[model samples]
Target: MDPLLSLFDPQVDSDSEDIIITETRSATLLSQNGSLPPECEEGNIEYKLKLINPSKTRFEHLVTQMKWRLREGHGEAIYEIGVEDKGLLIGLSQEEVNASLETLYLMADKLGATITILRERIITNDEDNCKARKYTDHRPHKCRKAVEVLVRKVPDDQQTIELRIAVLGNVETGKSTLLGVLTQGETDNGRGSARLNLFRHRHEIQTGRTSSISKEILGFDNKGVPITYNVCRTPEEICEMSSKLLTFIDLGGHQKYLKTTVFGLIAMHGHYAVLVISSIGGVFAGTAREHLGLALALEVPVIVVVNKIDITDNRSLTQTLIQLETLLKSPVCKKIPVRVETEDDVFTYASRLTTDHIIPIFTVSCVSGYGLNLLYKFLYVLPPSVSVNDRQRLIDSKVEFQIDETFQVPEVGLVVSGLLISGLIREGDYLKIGPFDCGLFSPVQVSSLQRHKVASRSVRAAESATLALMSYNNDIDLEKSVRKGMVLIEINDNSYGHKICQYFQARIHVLFHVSMLCPGFQTTIYIGNVRQTAVVVAIMGKKYVSTNESASVMFRFIKQPEYIKNGSRLLFREGPSKGIGHIVQVFPIITKTNDNSL
Candidate 1:
């Protein structure tokens, strides 16, 4: 992590939009203001003085370099033309820039990639204002410009680059409204008119509160244009036209819906968490902070959004920002906060998210659409935190799909929706579903699957989808047998990861609790898509553990056995008490009525 700043940058205390790139490293926003930062030794970002023309050998080498950069970025990279290797912004003339762009186009085309001109800035130079004015010529020219372009090439195996971001904040923080505006290509009416498009239930529409997990996507095509234009009016159209997809897992923000929120966090396979804060109230005294903590504990990268700026007064807005800055600097989060206001801020800060502990703070209003373009551009270029290698490894590993939500559509029959944690699933592939209440696995086949509301023949790891299932034996009721938190795994004669466990041991740290936590303390446990109540049957080598204390504890699922894998991270909570840990050991199956102690 970059060294933490002792305090929030004083320049940010004002109500003016922040233009910070927290890291003083390459491509720092401040450096770009007067001079380009020194070229970075590594990363997908590259600097070029000008590529107007090159020899065949040099062109081939440049193409190879571009290929490496695309791989490093997992499909996308930034090329800063008219910038020198020594951090000088000695821009190029228009003709040179045109030729350079033509060369870039050829380079991208040669590598089967596409290019999008991100932005171009004309650099001004006044000899009269120079320190060496006496030695300067009579005329000053400002025709040169610095251009930034995005080059993208999706890997051969993937159709679209998908990134899931869980939207979390207190109720009325504009989570739903924000998504509605971004996906619907319309601003709110100050009365949250845009939000109406996202509500799934009557109560949500009437009360303006979300009680369930709703999803909406914002997509970008290979040319980096948002697919929300009038022509692409439907999800299917957006999916069909997009090369990159951003799935916003809109979660409930009320305290009562915390479980739903937590489930969404774990089950959605989120690559990042967008913590939306209301500018009027800052981080709500309760749910918002809790959501941020949950995201950090889960190790998910977070981006902050302070919404409703259109309604907030300057004084209050400043105060809220200061508070957030202070809280993020605290030991609990230890995050470097970057304030984003422009397109430059977006690229500089967003490109470095996965490499550092920096968190970019975006202030926007759904009503006025303030600062929204920056946010949209940021999401467009935001890289997935999961590396291509790791995702590929999971896709090749044993098949494991988690069940979080299930539906029974009229013509589709029984449909199960959740994330495919690993491996692949194809239509008609035989798979084992569940460690039913009886603690055993059953055989089932995938009738069909859908991705992004479009029927698809197959699904891959790290992708969320709805799978229609068919059980040939009919020994178990499809509607009654399948439940949330169950597994759908590849059929194996040995039957691994298909059995349930009644008790397991874990190393846990208590986050908060009034009194010492003793054996028999029970709480709701959430691991992946699994949610169940468990009791601490025993504390290893210790009788009691209090707040901030760590201990190895044995837990028994109070209701029924659950399919828990070893080394899986988990979160447990009850009332004001909470803890996070991982399953260190999963014991063999024990019947629900078993009373034998370990």
Candidate 2:
């Protein structure tokens, strides 16, 4: 028997001087020279975790639980390593690793064993590889981006922190009214909201409507929860800003901006989203569909604020709440909280009304200043923390500069103008161009970076930067590689693109119908720079879209093209018409049956 396996045996005497080797089905425990054997160590380190049970858990969950236990000073616990798949692999920091060890001690106690960890000395002769490895662990995952924007760590007791709130919703959904009412004393009637503190102060702040789409710091809590907010208009803007940990994202209420709204909800990855449904507008109409879609897509906690209650007929607030409850109970937003609040003082009174677990609803007249206090209080109570991490979810902080116009500078060969989706990109950063084709070498060093066409020192993620990248002497296919809708990302070590048809499947929401026979027909696709014609081998949907229905369709591309990673904007064009439908699934193919693939 392996020396490590013998230590874990139940029959092994606890007082044995020689290393007691014991084996359980999955894990082998040993106490020899204060370190376990290499294979056993590898087994524990490479253990696949499940989410359902404590024993069977994912890496991130296990690490998190371990950290918590260690912080509480409990050592020695045993966890059954579960299987890992689909973005469940979590890379922990040094601090997190230490915390896990502490928790592992707790596991040891639970399982009646004393365990110790031995550091693996990784000696490397290559300088670049070592640097890349060091940075890679600190940086986002190889494939996805790390969460760049973090909530400024605050003391547990402090309730208020400076927060930047972006007012978002469909057009004419009282978005402007809400902003105007909140900034009545400060903002002019025609002007929109830029920055106004809902918290009372002596003098009003003259905040100009932000001229750019990039996130701007609005204010901070006296204790410093930096409130930086930006209003999103385009899909690029939504994608960029939502990648950060913005305190409050107020979506635009304009119906035309549905795409922006959807992207914001998904990208922001908010733990809690405030869905403002106008009471006068009823529950299920134009903007309601849009809001409902967001509520469905993201299973985050939602607070539905029913605006314009004052304008409604004799129907009491209670009746409207009941109406909202009925709709929210649907799969989209279940157990939504509704509240009817009249106008009151901004600070003292507003914070009192924002409680209620499932869905906190507030009925306020943005025009009449009614229920404004309640909104403030609710905003105050929001959890100021971000989710696991953007990189863990395969989200990258990118800047998609719409090639609005380009020009050549004397010093720099070619200068491209566009908005950064996310991440602060400066000069000399090695950019991965169109997959790993050239191996992340052709560096697009920033000769000059600008915002609103004006030059600036550094450009932040989700902001617009008119950057002048040092062009390669040899003219690469810049047209196809760097064109409209092309994204720029700083490549991480694990950032390898995959061209797989069976990429952990999921149901898709396909729009724009061309032919009924198109269901099972395979066709060519051009996603980013990838051009592959795959067979529309299988369609995974029973319900057909009478008008617009979401279904999962499977395709087997002719030649699997690299750079066509999951969620790489799939543009399916039938025959000559280039793009017929958009591709949303890139993470995993959720459901599948045998014999479906060719």
Candidate 3:
């Protein structure tokens, strides 16, 4: 095993003498007696013999290198003191070690970070010889020690870290129950009592199944403690108290509501997906495999959860795990399944979840409250996939908000809920929202903004919120003009040429088509939050296409023109056929015709 991989291993004793060291060495660290390693390498881990008494230039260079390593590890890095470039344990004296640690603190201070000593182990003369022993005869002949320190930077922004997770699996897999237990801070009564609060409609409560997309939140403070109804009274309080928030998009698990589930997975921009499997039923009943395939196709990282473990025996649980492992390792889903059994497993798996192939499997029972703490810890440590650079770009770009759902409240006249895809939006800002019947945008004012039911003055990019809109045109009816899939864009000083399109060309790859796809085939296409029926008017270079085939197709919406952008991901489905593609070209609607005959 790689020595760095074992850094978080729970079984390894930090103070033991039998410490495992890798053959890899850092070329940047200066060695006393030996030369630098043959290959220079820089990564999350760095080695240093000691940092006591360095020149001014050398100190600046060291600080810069530390900053690079911290960024490489996503705001975290590990340093090994009293080690040479060739993995040699050249132990330092007690005085030298203290000075080295003090220098590390200085470096961290300069970099706006905090340092924590993870471990320390002493080395005697028998195990490894110190090169400085030959020169220092007046020092005491005591064992010298090496220290491992972790440096983490404080997040720059004050806004809470938000991560959207889509919860999906087959029906009756305890999806709602697990989320209820997680967010409500209450265990199940074994009769589906915990999930009652999450249901939206009477039909869902009566049938004990979710048919619509619902949302729940799990908040964690800076110290990683969960803040739920036990401590907070409302979602606003939870948001205000949390430093990190996990928005759970609870989607339906049945095949009948597959469209709604697909929309939730695609439109919500989920960073990760949690696939719940019932221990008694094992797998492959209704939509387990389908949900898994959809997640993979959409390029969403997945974590597996085996629910209702309190009812299953050991043998059955083992069997279920075996079956899941086989499916995950299959060709269709090439994922490395790591069963999380301890806190160490949670830390290791959460750190590597962005790798796309590592799938962590967790088993828990909401009724018995087994293995739920580990799950919560994993979520608390899970990092958002959106990079700092990407977020900055979004903030610098023009404002674009995709409308997902709209409402006409009694007090709040016209309210629209959706995601802010780019730029920032503040209360009382004037913007244009449209693509009405005439395919034109209309000016509107943002009366107010609410996020997670908490009223806020402003909402930034990649955050979900509801904006109460006031139409500037008193003659127009807001309810008749505004609809789902419309966008609210900020009107700049040079805004021009923004119109909706009825026809567009896209490059599509059919995932699976029962029959050949030809021209005039009608299907429901979902792009962002837009769901409309479109017919294939032309196939660029082919007469017909089949499963796993690629082609360029021209589609015309059956209804009015919709506002769509180029390079947007689109999913079209009809019956058992489904395809995923992106919009490559858009043709604007031409409403005016000149009379040439006159």
Candidate 4:
């Protein structure tokens, strides 16, 4: 097999190895005499054009300066790839280099520029270093450390390709269980025993769900390229690592856990998002509807995983598949059924199913370690280049939470437990929390944080984060500062928030048959996982609202919710059921169409 082909195959290598390129170039520019100078002369392109490390900030900075020189009539600067980090750094003419220095100074003030060797030399050594560094070995290359130089040509095309996959679904749908099977290998021993022990013995909580994200790594060879898969626990974690990786994010799918907002569905950012539907349940739940709405908004590619096939009846499985297909008819879902019976069966099924064009199914029990290979193969076979931007704003993004629990520790000072929809807080980071939205808020410090039972240094934008913090102001009112379902963050964006007596807008495709809709009826409004009893003060676009024909509506929340800020989001949880309709707006009834009385 060709060397390049082997690099792209996962079966070949386990780690990324640098691919080398060799090239020779002619000295096109003439000396003062209009002829090629002797090899000893520094003016000769043959001697001056050499490859330097690209990854080094110094190398990239030099290249950028060289481009500016070439643009300013410094003549062509040629180069070749030497070491992977040292691609090629071409030297520019003296006058051009001087001009490039001015542009560099301007960019440094706003976004902090890396301390480049060239910049360091220019700043410290000034004229002498510039003259000497430009010509010979007398002046060292502007670098943090001495660098080896290699004569080489830069490749015309340098492309960095990566894949991002997200897994999202309702709560208790075995989201984390399937993640264990897919990512488990000889190296993984499951979530750290130390963490599990803490929850079981210390917390006294019967059920432990994912609090913060977890991280794992999978390395294999694809063709000849060394393929490294960075596996993360949540969608936000995936984005943080997306800068340079083929990342796969495993999200927790639980209806009650889903924060339901643009911020809540953040884990959905990927080339494609895979929805895990349990065959154990046999039907789409409310959480499924929320996920579908976000998917529709983003117009992303959806792949459905029908997990736990070993326990589900074939008849129920078939029906579930049909229903999912019908609901997601736009791109149509690629279905993969998972059955776990034995460890050996894991890889056997993984390899077979992903090779086919259709969605492949493998039976594996995460507990017993089955069908793991099939999961890996399916992930490795995914196509490249997918974007999710258009439907990103389908629901409101800003939100606050109803504190299900809160307490204070002498070591930490204060610990707040609640759902988050809008603003993000990280460990050791400082935040302002209080009423009046102004000076009332005292800066609070977060230290030693725990999410879902997993202790994390920090937490992202999520409905879950059982936070432990220390506030500077002890006199501050903890109760009044954070109201249940109150606005935790007043988002800067005017377009977000719960609009009362306002039309609640949403995108409802023909796939979703109307189950129930109460116009001008009293129902509880839940925003950012905070449940509050509020009447549906009014409904707009009557013709479209009732027919389920209109895509958006304005819902006037009966009372001005405490924490709900402008552009914040809310969902309708009818009667005793835990979850229900999506809310796009909540505001005062100013229009004549207002029907429901306060």
lDDT, candidate 2, 294-362, per-residue tens: 453334455567777666765755566666665544332334343434222222122222222245567
Q: What is the alpha-carbon lDDT of model 4 when measured against the actual structure? A: 0.39
Predicted structure with the largest TM-score when compared to the true one: 1
Please count the clashing residue pairs in each candidate, in the order shown: 0, 70, 0, 79
Candidate with better lDDT, 3 vs 4: 3
Best by lDDT: 1
Model 1 lDDT tens row, 176-238? 999889898888888978888789999999999999999988888886677773558677888
- Where's the lowest-lDDT run of ten residues in candidate 4? 149-158
lDDT of 3 at 580: 85
After superposition, which runs of candidate 3 have C-alpha atoms over 4 Å from their true positions? Answer: 1-155, 493-499, 591-598
TM-score for each of the candidates: 0.88, 0.46, 0.82, 0.43
- By descending TM-score, how would the candidates be arranged? 1, 3, 2, 4
Model 1, residue pairs in steric clash: none
Candidate number with the higher lDDT (1 or 3): 1
lDDT score for candidate 1 against the true structure: 0.81
lDDT value, residue 567 of candidate 3: 94
| Rank by lDDT (best first) | 1, 3, 2, 4
Clashes of 2: 70
lDDT tens digits, residues 208-283, model 3?
A: 9999988999898756789887788899899888877899999999878988998888888898999999999976
